[model samples]
Target: MIRKLAIIGVGLIGGSMARALREEGVVQEIVGCGRSKPNLERAVELGVIDHYTHDIGEAVRGADLIVLAVPLGAMEATFRAMQDHLADDAVITDVGSVKGSVVEDAVKVFGEAPAFLVPGHPIAGTERSGVEASFPELFRNRRVILTPLDNTDPQALQKVEQAWRHCGADLSYMAVAHHDEVLAATSHLPHMLAYSLVDSLARMKENDEIFRYAAGGFRDFTRIASSNPVMWRDICLANREALGGMLKRFADELHGMADALEKDDAEGLLEIFERAKAARDRYIDGVE
Candidate 1:
């Protein structure tokens, strides 16, 4: 059992994890660290944390487990500040969406001092943020992926798995490179497309028409586009290579669609739409 846990960010995901673990008695104590005093205080008031601190090192002082829950861009800075204070036997993990850059940046901070650092990503999030947006069961039934490097400690990796399992999450192990490639297709590229489409539409003279006549499909498609811009921007930059590759593939498919439309290829268009419909239906029915 993890007796002490320190979370570097007390926003939606971090706060929710703190609340979930504490509610389930998975951890005896949780210290939330963030720049906002009010956010930290609100987290404590919500019973999500046992203590709060603006000082990163102070908050993680004696924690047996440390979760770097900030934005992907903030990983390096956060790790640098907390590296000096990590407990000798602490197992470090993160809730970053993109793992490749995080793992690469964090290795130096952890050093070769028999440290156990595991980079993890949870394929789950609400379209909300901040301390007020958290709930105890946010990760319940969600898939949590841990991307461990070659040098990761077996015992430490197991402990990280145990923590996620205790949070009611299903676990999967992946390599950092493969994780980025898979996520580029399943998550990042879609978000970028959504943001692009929304931005393009928002620039139209009849923007109101697009939003006013939006159906459920439009709403669902653009939901992630409404996510925090700063966070998403950092993710795009951090995982630019894989995202760029996916974008190229998307462009190729788009050219095919354009060609079909230009040539009045009704059969091709129908087949394309059918493929999309079949794929979406299967996903909706949880067939995948």
Candidate 2:
């Protein structure tokens, strides 16, 4: 059990983890750290953390487990700020979506990937932010991927794996590059498309009418567009290489569909629609 767990950036992801750990008695204490003192104080008052601090060094000083839940862009500065305060035995982990940039940042800050520093991503969250939006059940039945470096300490890796499991997440392991590519295609691309579609529609001449007539499909598809812009901006920038590649491929596919429609090619349109529907059904069936 973690005697003291310090969670940096006590927003939805961090607050959820703290709530889950506290509920499960997996940790003795949780210290919430963030730039906003009122947010951290509110987290404490909501019982998401035992204590709150604006100082990263103070929060992580004696923590055996430190969870970095800040945005991808903030990883480097946060690591540098808390490195000196981290215990030698402390196991460091993060909940960043993009792994390649995170791994690179770890190397830059520490000169190498420390055995105790584990890069992780929890594939779960609502289109919500802040401490109040968090819930203990956020990670329940969700997938949490860990990308461990070659030099990672076996004990540290196992401890983090166990901790996520305790939080009700199913664990998986992947290479950093592979994880980045997969997430770029699966998660990042969809979010980008959603934001673009919503933005385009909202700028139309009959914008209010368009929204008024919007049905369940538009609402469901653009739900993620309501997510924190800063977080998504950082994610897109962090995984730009993979994300750009995926975007190009998606654009090619869209162009093909448009061409088929313009040419009045029923077979081509049917082939594309049928293939996508079948693929989506198979994916849903597999997940279910």
TM-scores, all models, native as reference: 0.95, 0.98
Question: Which pairs of residues collide in candidate 2?
Answer: none
In terms of lDDT, model 2 sits at 0.93
lDDT for residue 175 in candidate 2, whole number 0-100: 95
What lDDT score goes with residue 241 in model 1?
A: 98
Model 1 alpha-carbon drift over 4 Å, by segment: 108-115
Q: How do the residues 125-224 of candidate 2 rate in per-residue lDDT, one tens digit apiece?
A: 9998999999999999999999998999999999899899989999999999999999998899999999999999989999999999989998989999
In terms of TM-score, which candidate is strongest? 2
Best by lDDT: 2
Model 2's C-alpha root-mean-square deviation from the true structure amounts to 1.0
How far residue 55's Cα lies from its native spot in candidate 2, in Å, is 0.7
Tell me how many residue pairs clash in candidate 2.
0
RMSD of each: 1.7, 1.0
